[model samples]
Target chain A: MVDLTHTLSPEFPFLPVEGKTFPFRSSPIATIKGDGVYANRWELTEHVGTHLDAPCHFAEGAMAIEAIPLETLFVPLAVVSIAERVATNPDTTLGAGDLMRWEKDHGEIPARAAVFLHTGWDVRTKEPGAFVNMDGAKTMRFPGFSDKAIEFLLGRRSISGIGIDTLSIDPGRDKEYAVHKELFRAGKWAVECVANLSRVPATGAFVFVAPVKVAGASGAPARIVAVW
Target chain B: MVDLTHTLSPEFPFLPVEGKTFPFRSSPIATIKGDGVYANRWELTEHVGTHLDAPCHFAEGAMAIEAIPLETLFVPLAVVSIAERVATNPDTTLGAGDLMRWEKDHGEIPARAAVFLHTGWDVRTKEPGAFVNMDGAKTMRFPGFSDKAIEFLLGRRSISGIGIDTLSIDPGRDKEYAVHKELFRAGKWAVECVANLSRVPATGAFVFVAPVKVAGASGAPARIVAVW
Candidate 1:
């Protein structure tokens, strides 16, 4: 049993959007002397941390959290670690060849599996500057998917979704977000900000990426877990 | 595999508060979109819909969402259905006697198992009005646990936590919230607003309730599933 979701708090570094202010604050709902009790009060964006992006985030009429089938959310999973490669190049993008090599080393990715790309990117979460990687140009730098990699997964593999350790499935410099377009167009989902992938076995575990049944929203925070 | 979470939407009701109001309403992120996108933007109180309450919800310095051990969150579960009784009384509360009778029918609840109480209360979710149950008095009436049931579960069972099909673990009319205190004091967590427990067997299914890793959060929306 391993928890792959990241902890969401006020301290969790959020995605920096230029010009627009991000709502990322959470306060404890204090108890009144004569009133009732309910503990926390959260005031933040839907996509704060460890969240899932629905097609509607980019493409309209895509599947939202509630409409995604339960079977698609819970499936067999395979974790392919590219930590060493990502450690060397923060802007590194994983491609199909990389995943093929991973499959060669581990085993075939089963049908209906969630292919998790473990880049060891989450270790830097505590260091806000490093995690978000805000540069002088105001653009961020993070390891993500190569356009070809996403295409390969959807076109060739029998997969339900792809998960990554970084904030976005596409590189920070990717303004087009081609990877997201491909995955969403293919009727698949993406899980982001996953942690502790190193703790999971390469295969034989079931992944549960249950997002909130938020109606008509583009995306929602998901609490993903892997059951062995 | 059937999903048991309520869809959180703009129309999905939340616990009311006596505070200054705003004309602009931020809609909840719709969970499912077509063509493989789900919830791009979600807005809700942490305690809304299908959620898990950590001990830190009321017991400060206690376990936060991330601090609770994975073993505690991912244990084997036992479903104890009180739906038949709840059908007669919407305010029916589960007590020790109910649990004892359940044991006779389904055998003893194992130590550290997640005890899910299925009250058939979720039928109202199809219609928002009955789901929130806001009447002229503004008080919600729903099935939940009696204080005595809370004491019995904590004192007699080495259970991981309790799950309920209603909006809260306590009766909506509960003023003191003794159930919350009793469970939190014992370092137990909760799964609320769960559905489809009636589809699962009374025992043998494993309940997975993994919430977003919210730091110091009393609770967060959880993606719950059952594997038989």
Candidate 2:
């Protein structure tokens, strides 16, 4: 099994909120001394860290974390390494053409398999600037699934979810979030901010994602793993 | 594949901290407007919700979350239902003898399998009084693994981790937390606050527990799943 969750430390980067200030700082919770043992406490948004997006997160009347079928959470997984492309162009966008090339190299994505796009964006996590990519315009820019890529994967192929190493499945500059809407509307899930996809196999592994059941909440931080 | 995680809503119970109450509110982060997205900021301690305990959680110089081998996290799993006993006594403390009785009823604890103790304690999650059980001098009293139980399970059986549906592996009244210390010291890991164990069978299932790669943190919350 390969762990694909990032450390939930304060130092881990957080997605920028366009308008309002983020409720909690991207920092570790405090460890309070109990009568004897210590208990940790901190502020966090459900969608931060390595997390899963339920259909309700982007579409109304859609499945919540609890409503997602357990079978869909763990399935055969394919980790297609897009690291070289991402390395060549940090702001690269993945379209259906790119996925086709990957499918040519890797076998077809089996039904209900988690198609993990390993872009090697996680290495930037060590460097704050690169990880967040907050250089020029107010918006951040990182590789993400283009509209056509998401359509081809969710509509054409039978996939349970999409897992990515970057902060979101959509490009940081995407204001409309069409890819996210389409995926969730299709009743599929997405795993965000996953780490160590580079360590997993290109095929034949099973991806296991378990999100906390936050009652009626849109989404929650989750720990995603891959087992052969 | 089964999702064994409880949703984190205002209704879900959390381990009450003694001090520093800045977080842990019903909704810590704001929901992203018009996007159906929720929470952009990161907050909370490594140990929150459905989570895992690395050896370092209690013992000094023990394995960190990342340092723990992958083989240990994804192993065969066995769920031993004790809901009958817990219904009679929420304070019931499971000992070595109890475990033996369970093994006699259900087959033996398989080698290298995670033994999930299902007490059905999660029903009280919405009731603070029943969930916390802070009634008498004991402050709290709920089903948990006894010291004797940990000793036998770790010393005799070839197991990877112990998972429980309760908030903590040890009973709420436990002062020394011997179970946590001994298990970690002995190189075993644990999963706490798991939900939906009833949805899984007693055997032929695999427990998928993955902790976040927090550099040197003692423990981190996990998204645990069971695959049959």
What's the distance in Å from true for residue B185, model 1?
Answer: 1.0
Task: Identify the runs in model 2 with alpha carbons over 4 angstroms from their true place.
Answer: A18-36, B20-23, B26-48, B64-66, B104-107, B212-216
Give the DockQ of candidate 2: 0.45
iRMS, all models: 4.5, 3.9
Residue B175, model 2: lDDT of 67
lDDT of 1 by residue, B92-116 (tens): 8888999888889888888889988
Most DockQ-accurate candidate: 1
The residue-by-residue lDDT of candidate 1 on A71-125, one tens digit each, is 8888999988778978788888888998898889878789999988888988878
Q: Each model's TM-score?
A: 0.90, 0.86
lDDT of 2 by residue, B1-228 (tens): 677766554445666655432223554244546445554333455566677877766666778776878788888998877788889888787788977887897788888989889999877766756877876574678889889988889888889889888878998887678888889889888888888898999888987776655556667666677777
lDDT of 2 at A93: 76
Q: In CAPRI terms, where does candidate 1 land?
A: acceptable
Tell how far residue A92 is off in model 1, in angstroms: 2.1
Clashes of 2: 10
